[model samples]
Target chain A: MNITLAQARQVVAGALAAGRAASYKPLTVVVLDSGGHVVAVEREDGASTKRFEIAHAKAHGAVALGLGSRALMARAEQQPYFIAAVTQTVGALVPVPGGVLVRDADGGLLGAVGVTGDTSDHDELAALAGIEAAGLVGQPD
Target chain B: MNITLAQARQVVAGALAAGRAASYKPLTVVVLDSGGHVVAVEREDGASTKRFEIAHAKAHGAVALGLGSRALMARAEQQPYFIAAVTQTVGALVPVPGGVLVRDADGGLLGAVGVTGDTSDHDELAALAGIEAAGLVGQPD
Candidate 1:
């Protein structure tokens, strides 16, 4: 199922709020629809200049692969060269821990959310929190 | 000036509606901030898979240079080497007719809008309509 535009904004809002509430470093968040196209993106005022691109790359990686970046990392351990090849050739993804897939109740992917500008674990925490706040299921790594 | 997420979405909504009202081909629209980062993008159902990238490239080109793609095209005629250098080095822009800059009433640059999946003229028309609908100005090329 495709994610609505409203849902995409909600994910950004949720993720950013989580970052703020936790007093994490400033962040940038991105939401992508099922087709791996960006739906929405936002960068906090204090976020690093590179935050948005990193967030976008993470979200793209998640949606393009139909799996969370965490899962991809595990897979990458088994095939590092393949992951490297995909990133180098396509320039479409950055398999990392900050990307999370959003799914419908039936486990059908709706899209993905990505967070950047913090530790990988913190970024993942924010993304997962956003998914839950939006009442969407986030698949476990 | 900056384009708010709400304004970005309104532009997409307006452009897509204009496409439908005119019975144009399915389209994909993208909005980018002055920083050349995407604010939002949407591909209408039935749009070609390639439309999103085209739209994004168009928008990126517009904002990066602070000129509409039409203007860029004209400049490209005189400076093909410059355009080639930019494409090869940055890999972020596609200077072409469907991209337009968005501005505030004071002519402050906000960002840009790009549309794809139709003739370039039609794509530009839709982008202008969207800019007007969002209460912003579109700098005509």
Candidate 2:
């Protein structure tokens, strides 16, 4: 099933709330449909403006490559030139841990969520929290 | 005060509601802070994937030039080359009516709201409605 706008909002809210609860730096959250189109995005009041673009790029990279950004990070380490080419081709991409794939119970692709703030690992945890809050599974790898 | 994520979401919700109430096609709404950075963006399910980019460009142009998109459209008609050059320099800009400048009571620039889906006029109207719904001023011209 496709992720609806409502669910996307919930994901964003959950991610931000998680960040706040963890006392992380202000976070930006983006939810992208399976097609890599933006469903919704929210940048916290004090978050750096660039966080929005970074968050979107993370989600876009995950959806476009059909792999969680964590996996992409590993690939980038093994094939830096390839990841660089892909980033150039995609306009914007960040091979990092904060981008997570969303799936249904049967492992159907739904969409993806990207969170940015604090540490990358903390960002990924918030993303997973958001996906679960929206009743979807988050695949970080 | 700056436009918070909460207010940006309100603006997007208001714009989409306005479009639906007017029986317009699916719409994409984007909110940009005064720095021309994205604050929030939402694309309706049926909106074309490109709508997000269009909407962001519209708002970006407004925030970048300190003029509403309707005014930009007029300038474009008078000096096509200037507008074209600016678009190229800015990387992305839409000199159309849908981009609206947002302001506070004292005429302080707060941000901008952009909407894309229906006719340019309808899009501008929706953007205005959204700004008003969020208790901010929308300068369409």
Q: Which predicted model would earn the best DockQ?
A: 2
Model 2 per-residue lDDT at A95: 93
Chain A TM-score, candidate 2?
A: 0.96
- In the range B22-94, model 2's lDDT, one tens digit per residue, is 9998889999988988889888878887888999989999988889999999999999999999998886889
For model 2, the superposed segments whose C-alpha errors exceed 4 Å read none
Per-residue lDDT tens digits for candidate 2, residues A15-62, read: 888888999998899999888888888888888879988998888899
Q: What is the lDDT of every predicted structure here? A: 0.82, 0.90
Q: What proportion of true contacts does candidate 2 retain?
A: 0.88
Clashes of each: 0, 0
The parts of candidate 1 lying over 4 Å away from their true place are A1-27, A33-35, A39-47, A63-66, A72-86, A89-92, A117-119, A129-135, B75-86, B89-92
Give the per-residue lDDT digits (tens) of candidate 1, residues A36-111: 7766666665465567678878888887777888888887899999999888876767677999989988988888
lDDT of 1 by residue, B48-90 (tens): 6567779988888888777898887888899999988887776
> Share of real contacts kept by model 1?
0.24
